[model samples]
Target chain A: MTYCVALKLDRGLVMMSDTRTNAGLDNISTFRKMHVWEKPGERVLTLMTAGNLATTQAVISILDERMKAPEEREPSIFAAPSMFQVARIVADTLREVIGRQADSGQKADAAFNATVLLGGQIAGGPVRLFLIYPEGNFIEASDDTPFFQIGETKYGRPILVRAFERTMSFEAAVKLLVVSFDSTIKANLSVGMPLDVALYEEGSLSLGTPWRMEANDAYYRTISEGWGDALKQAFDRLPDMELPTSG
Target chain B: MTYCVALKLDRGLVMMSDTRTNAGLDNISTFRKMHVWEKPGERVLTLMTAGNLATTQAVISILDERMKAPEEREPSIFAAPSMFQVARIVADTLREVIGRQADSGQKADAAFNATVLLGGQIAGGPVRLFLIYPEGNFIEASDDTPFFQIGETKYGRPILVRAFERTMSFEAAVKLLVVSFDSTIKANLSVGMPLDVALYEEGSLSLGTPWRMEANDAYYRTISEGWGDALKQAFDRLPDMELPTSG
Candidate 1:
């Protein structure tokens, strides 16, 4: 169980993901879900994964290895002609990983399935964001639908739907993601702390250092507690309903 | 495809249910999901249904018949001595309906399952709320869990978790319910307008005339729009995060 979200804003892309992975309630572990492959001045690519840990790790490892050994593996993550091609490569990697799991005698089921959020840019292409499915298919975010959420998405969606703006500053975008993730972490045990975040400013063609937010981060605490107080006050501001007097 | 929620507060019980039902995305219809049987000054029982419409309607019909013909039908709903017994009767009725469908040679599936939320006072018994499953079992709300939401519950849950209070006034409770329902309606096509609501004040031993809120209802509009603005204001109040300087 994981919660990963990416927004394709007018300025660039903002992505965040929880680090918790669990085989069962008692068997929980923390693993980085956000993976980055940057080419400095040429391109920047970010991937956030959710689903079977083995499948995601395998997909990431394959992508990483392909980037380093482009002579051996064609269409490397670093060599994708555009963001769409990158999404296609990531989707194929996910399906390839799941296929390997099935070939290893595991029954055909969703056990090896993985979903990935891919967002980045190349030197010539415009910034793009996509949600890649386990089946090697993907959907790009556009003006009407500017964000994608995977895994435990519902708990945090209302806030995003109400607050997200394509023109908002990176600071506000990060703050919104924090509030969204905070709501999810509080509601679901599967999505825990120490969130991994990446900010890609359009046209920069470079990825900045990713930020990690821990459970005890003062800013996270402020937003968590402040949001609660704000919500209560907001509830109070709604006009009261007139109760029916008779049956 | 419905959304019904009930809250057990210090004052009494506040329940709300959307009126939408659907056989498929193309075959949507409106049907009342909230039902009430009140013996003025003696007892009040409010039930909200979600899931298979046939199963729910059958269960409601059986309960309605048993109440009117107590001499012919043993363990009539009105004859139940306690709220727990009332829940038992409702749960059993639900299973009976599903069992009948199974006996008709239909493949056993969730197609015939229905979940119910029941809440009210039975004179001497304290005001109680319950969530009855299709398998003839139910769980009562406690101090820790003072609310029950069935069908398309996730989108509306965060607000309830953060804002609900046991001692909140009926005005606040109803306002909270409206916000919750509004969120669900926006997120799910299966849950629509013309919501049915019931208010049971403890010691009254009677249910008031259930209110019907339409899509064009003025107060509903006020809250729906007000909530969006309030949330935006709340998000703006949260302190901004300092972006990482380098990779």
Candidate 2:
């Protein structure tokens, strides 16, 4: 299990992913789930994946191979004309990789499966965020639901539901996201840290410097401490029930 | 969908359940999920059900019928020797009702489909809480995990993970529970008001007067407002990312 979130805010795009993977509780391991493909000022695309780690890594490796063999691929992530076309390129690459893996006579239950949070900006268009499903189909974030979450999503859903908005400042958005991730991390052992967070300004063609929040990072510490204190204070403020004297 | 939680604390027991049921998003209705059976001084039992509404209703009907036919039944909830025995009776009745309904072919899928949170105190026993699975088996709450939630549980899990403790005061437990419920309600539309809350002090054989909190209830209003504000404050206190100037 993993937890990854991407937000399409007016200021820009914010993407975060946890780095823990477990085949079972005893086989837990850390793996980077965020992959960035950058072509300087032309295009910048980031892919955060969840679901079967082998499938996701295979898909990423295939995409990287395509970028290297530029003669064979005309519409790779590096050359896509727009963000929408770039998303199409990603979906196509994922489908092909999954198909190749499935054709190897693997057991039916062991078929390749992965979902990706694709977010980036092209020089000519707006920053966009998409949640690509295992079937290679995808949905873009819209005004009503301006964010997408994949993998172990429910534990972190409350903060996003209550606080996310199109008009939120980028700073507030990132903070809310960290708090959300903190909640998820505490509740689920499958989602651990060394969080990868990327913020893209709306018009910037290149991605901003990605932040790696390590375990015991001071900012995450503040978020966790503050949240715990706030919950206690909130609990204290709620009115107590006035029970009847007779039982 | 529904959300029901019951906690076993050192001083008492706390139980709360939402009243929303939906066949689909288009077919929504309110159906109380909490049921109480008390012989006052002899025994007190509360059951909160989540899952197929028809199946839970059938189970409740069976229990009610057994009470009505006391002459034929060797032991009813009113006559059960201990809370543990009462839980077995509840689980068995649930399975029997569901089995009978399936045999009639009215709804085969509904067979033994409801999960229940059963909690109460018998005249001579300690307060006990059990989580009854659809298979008619159950697990009692222990010191490590002192609370049980039956439906739409993930959205509310973070608060409980951070706040619940074996020695929490009864007042603190109830407030923590309301905040947890508020988080779930905000995240999922399928779980809603009014909420039924029952608090039973340890060694008390009967429940204290249960409170029905409606959408506009003052205490609930405070919980919603206070919790949202508290979360935002917590978010603000988190440290901002200090990313390197160049990637």
Candidate 3:
């Protein structure tokens, strides 16, 4: 299991993904789930994947190879005219990989399914974020839903729903995502640290080098411990239930 | 879908369950998920269920009938020697009902599975709680794992993990549970009000009348709105992330 979240704030997009990948309880490994493509001031695209490791890696590898050899692969993400086109390419690739696995007599096609979170800007286009499903369909985040989370999402979702705002700074948004990720990591062993994070400033048309937050990272440690304490305090502040003595 | 949680605190047991029952998104009705059996000064047992409504209802009906006709049913929960025996009786009934459904040509046995949370005290026995599976196996809650939640559990679990303490008062535990349920109800439409709650104090050997928190209940509304504000304040209190501007 993986936990990847992308927030579309007014300032920009704040995205985070866990590094743990496991085939089973005993077969766990660290793998980067965030993939980014950039052509400086022209276009910037970030993709975070969750689901079967083989299928996601295949989708990423195909996209990466296309970027490296654009002449051979006609419809590379780099040359896509808009963010919508980039999403289409990613969705199609995901479906193609899973479809191949099923076509080869794999009894469970669902076993090969993968979900992707794609967010970035392409030159003149407005910043956009999309959640691409395992079925090759995708939906864009709007004002009503300004964030998308894939993999081990439920434990971390309530906090996001409660705290997120459109006008939050990039720094505040990243902090919020960290807290969300911490809650998920504590409840589920499948989503572990270190984390990979990417920040894209609106209209910059370029993404910074993604940050790697190791387990012992000072800030992550502070937020993880601090959030637990804050939660306890908040819980204590709630009005207590008064029991009736009769029964 | 449903959300039922039972905690074994030092004072006794605190349990809460939602009233939503649905065959599909469009077919929803309210049903009580919490059931209690008491012999006043002798024993008090409470059961909360989740999963297929048919299987759970069938299991509950059989248990209720056996208790009503103890002579014909030799192993009724009322005559059980200990909480362990009561758990076994409930687990066996659950397994029996599911097995019968599968035997009657139900293609998807998993669809008929039901899980139960049983907690109570019998005269000379210690206050105990058990999580009974559809397979007729059950595990008791202990100092280490003092609570059990069944159905739509993930969204509401983080706060419980952070706030639950064995020594907390029954009022505090119920307050914490309301917060948890509020988070779940906000995130999922399948689990909704009103809620059913039961409190069992050790040595009392009996449970008071269960509380029904209706959707319009003033206290429930206060906690629901207050929690959202408290969570936002908590999120703002966390240290903001510092980003490298050079990137």
Candidate 4:
């Protein structure tokens, strides 16, 4: 299991994902789920994956392989002309990977399915966010839905829906996501740290280096503990339930 | 779909459920999910249902019917000598309902399954809480796991986990659940107002009249709005994410 989130803010893009993955309670390992591709002064792309690890890894590897052989007829994510095209490439790669798994005798839909969150900016295109599903279809975030969350999304979603603001400062966006991730990590054993977070300024055509937040990171600790305390305080301040005499 | 939560606190028990049920988005309807059977000063039991409406209503009808036939051979819920026995009766009723459906050519497990939250105090037993699955098995809440949430539970879970304290006042518990329910309602269309909440004080041998929280309820508004503001405030106060210079 994994938990990944990306926000398309007015000022830029903020993406975050946890590194922990597990096949079962007894088999746990750490693997980076967030990837970046940068072409300074031209474009920047970020990808966060969830669902089947094999499928996601295969998709990433194929995209990376295509990038190396520029003369290839196939499309690579880096070669996409627009963010939409980038999403299409990622979705196609995901489909191809799943298809291969099915050819190898695995259940294509259940065993090899993967979902990806793609966010980036092309040289001439505006910043965009898309959630690519297992079927090679995707949905772009809009003004009404300015963010995308995948993998164990429900535990962390209430806080995001309650707190997210498209116009908030990038720093606040990062803080909000950290808190949301923290909430998820605490509630479910499947999603853990160190968490990877990236901040990309719109139209800069450059990807910000990602930050890895370990379990003991200062900000992580503050958000985890502080959010708990703040919640209790908030609960205490709420007015009491006033059931009338008959009810 | 529905959202129901039951908390086993040191002071007593808090149970809540939303009434919305739907076959499809267009076929949504309101149906009470919380049922109360209180024999004043003798015992109090609240049954909250989730899953297929037909299965739950069938189970409830059977139980209610058995109660009327005092000379019946079957063990009725009201006749149960202990809370454990009560849980067994409820589970047995659920299994019976499903089994009957299967015998009538329905896909019992898929089409007729219903999960129930059975909680109450019997005359001789301590305040007890149990989550009865469709398979006629059940698990009671313990000190470690003092709560059970069924249906659309994930969205409201984080707040409960963060704020739930066994020693907290009953009013606080009620407030916490309202906020949790409010969060779930905002994020999910299938779970909505009016919400039902019931309180049981240990040893009271009686149940409080349940409160019905409607869409425009003042307290619900306060929580829906107040919680959002409080979360933003908390996020704002968190120390900024100290991403490395490159991030």
Candidate 5:
């Protein structure tokens, strides 16, 4: 199981993903789920994946390999003219990989499915977020639905629905995502720490290094413990439930 | 679809459920999911249902009919000697109901399946809570677990996990459950308002009048809006996520 979330805000984009990957309770490993592509000052694209490790890694490897040798049949994400084109490249690559897996007598739609979250700025294009489905179709987030979460999403969703704001600062957005992730990590063991986070300021063409938070990172700890204490306090403040006079 | 939750606390039990039932998005209706049986100073038992409306309603109608005339093969739940026996009767009746549906060429395990949360106290037994499964098996809530949620549970679970206290006041428990249910209602259309809630005080031997919160109930509104605002305030107070000078 996995959890990856990305927000498209007025200021920019805030995206993060948990690092835990597991086939079962007995088998678990840490693997980075966020990928970055930067042509420094020219274009930057971030990709986050959740689903079968093999298929996602295969798609990433194929895209990365394409970048290494650009004179290929499929245009690399690096060469896409717009954010929409970049989404198309990623979706097509994901579909192609799943196709090969299906060709070998595998049920790629269910067992080997992988969904990707692509968000970034491409030169003149606006900062955008797209959720690419396992079927290769994709949907872009709009103001009404400014965020997208994949994998193990239900437990962490109510908080986001209650607190999200379009005009929140990049810093505030990151803080919100941290709280969301913390809630998910506590409710679900399949999503663990050592999170991969990337922030893309609107119009920043180049992707910079992202900060990774381990299990005990101070800021993450503050969000985790502080949010719990705050919730208790807030709970204490709610209007008391009155006993009914009769049924 | 449905959402029902039961908490076994030191003081007593607090249980609530949404009334929404649907075969699909287009086919939705309101149906009560909480049932209470109180024998004055003798005993009080509350049962909450979730899953197939047909199966759950059938189970309830059967139990009600049995109580109307206790000269039957299966003992009436009202005549059960202990909370454990109450659970057994409910589980067995539930299993039988599903079996009957299956015999009529229905898919009893999935489409017609139902889960029940039974909580109450009898003359000599301790206050107890049991989660009855579709197959007639049941599990009791312990000091550690102390709660059970059936149907559309994940969206409302994190708050329960974060704020639940075994020794809290009955009022506090109700407040917590209202918060949990409000969150579920906001995130899921299948779970809606006009919630039915039952609170049982230990040794009361009878349930007092339960409370039902409509969509615009004042206290429910306060908790719903207050919690959302309080969470936003808490999010604002959390330590800021510092952006690295380079990222």
Candidate 6:
């Protein structure tokens, strides 16, 4: 299982993904789930995927191959005119890879099962965030639901539901997201450390210096400790029940 | 869907369950998930069920019938020698009812799925909690894992993971459980308001007045508001990321 989350705020976009993938309990390994496509001041597109690793890798590999081809007629993430077209290219590539894998009998039940969080800004348009589904379709985040999460979502849902607001400051949004991720990592063993975090400032068509956070990263450690201590203090402050005495 | 949690602490036990049952998104109804069997000083047992409503109700009816039949050989909740035995009885009854129903060919794919949380103290035993599986086998909570939750459990798991301690005060335990329930209800529509809360003090052999909490109840409203505000405040206090800019 994987956990990836993205928030699109007025300041910019914040994306985080865990680096744990497992075929089974004994076959656990680390795999970065975030992919970045950058062309300096032209476009910067970040993709975070959750689902079967093989299928996602295939889709990424196909996109990379297209980018490297000298013929250059095929539309690549680098050449997409708008963020919407970039999303369409990614979805279509995913669907094609899934169809090919399904045609071959090598993969039986593991047909393409991947959801992508696509967030970035083009040179001219606004910064946008989308949740692309497995069937090659997508939905943009609205004011009602300001963020999107994929995989192992429930454990971290309370924090998002309670703290996420459209008007929230970017600093508050990032802190809340880290706390949410901390809660998920504590409850589930399938999601581990060494997180991939990327931030894209609005109107800047280049990625923020991405942070590769390990288990001992100081900010994460502080968030974990502070959140735990705050919860305990809050628990202590709730009013105690007044039990009725037996006459 | 449902959310039921029971905790065994030094002071006593706390059990809470939401009352919403939904067949589908459009077909939702309210049915109490908690059932209590008490014989004053002899024994007091509280059972909370989650999963298929029909199967859970059938098992409960079977258990009730066993209590009415004085000639029955095996012990029922009222007559069990220990809380452990009571859990086994509940699990076995659930399994028997499910098996009988499935054999009748009324449903396919084992529609007989339900889990039960049984917690209470017998006259001579220590306060205990058990989580009974659909197969009629159960596991008792220990010092390591001193609580059991069934139904939509993930949404409320973070609070218990952070706040629960074996020596927690009864008042603290009840309030923590209520806050946890509020979190679950907020995140999942299938688990809703009007909760059933029961507290059993050590050596009391009978439950305290069970609180039927409605959406507008003063204490519950306080918890909902206080918890949300506390979380937001905590989120705002966490330090923000210090990004490294490319020179």
Fraction of native A-B contacts kept, per candidate:
0.80, 0.53, 0.75, 0.62, 0.79, 0.60
Single out the weakest 10-residue window by summed lDDT for candidate 5 chain A. Answer: A238-247
lDDT of 5 by residue, A143-208 (tens): 899999999999989888988898888778888888899889998999999999888888767666
lDDT of 6 by residue, A1-247 (tens): 9999998877788888999999889999999899998888988889999998998999889888888883778888777888899899999988877777778876664545888899988888988889988788999987777789998999998988888876666566667778989999999999989888887878778787677788998988999999999878776766766543330
lDDT of 5 by residue, B16-111 (tens): 999999888998899999999889888898999998888999999988998888877768998878888889889999999888888887553577
Cα displacement (Å) at residue A247, model 2:
7.3
Per candidate, chain B TM-score? 0.98, 0.93, 0.98, 0.97, 0.96, 0.95
**Candidate 6 stretches greater than 4 Å from native:** A70-73, A106-111, A167-170, A243-247
Ranking by DockQ: 3, 1, 5, 4, 6, 2
Model 6 residue A1 distance off true place after TM-score fit, in angstroms:
0.4
In model 2, how large is the Cα lDDT of residue B245? Answer: 34
| Cα-based TM-score, every candidate | 0.97, 0.91, 0.98, 0.97, 0.97, 0.95
User: What lDDT would candidate 6 get against the real structure?
Assistant: 0.85
**Candidate 1 chain B worst ten-residue window by lDDT:** B238-247
Residue-level lDDT tens digits of model 2 in B1-247: 8999998888778888999999889999999899988777777888999988888998888788878888974457767888889889988877776677667767555534889999988887888899988778899998888889998999999889877877876667777888899988987899999999887877777777787889998778877887787666655555655544332
Distance (Å) between predicted and true CA of B80, model 2? 1.9
Candidate 4 lDDT over residue span A1-247, tens digit each: 8999999899889999999989889999999999999989988999999988988988889889999998999987778899999998899889888877878865546867889999999998899999999989999999999999999999899888888889987778888998899889988999998999899989788876787889998878887888888877777777876655222
- In TM-score terms, candidate 6 sits at 0.95
CAPRI verdict (incorrect, acceptable, medium, high) for model 5: medium
How many Å off is the CA of B95 in candidate 5?
1.5
Off by over 4 Å in 3: none
Please list the C-alpha lDDT of all candidates, in the order they appear.
Answer: 0.90, 0.82, 0.93, 0.88, 0.88, 0.85
What are the iRMS values of all candidates?
A: 1.9, 2.9, 1.7, 2.1, 2.0, 3.0
lDDT (Cα, tens digit) per residue for candidate 2, span A1-247? 9999998888888889999999889999999999998888888899999988888898788788878888993566877788788788788877777777778877763446888999988887888888887777899988888999999999999889877878876677777888889989988889999898887777667777787888898877877787788666655665664443333
In model 2, how large is the Cα lDDT of residue B134?
76
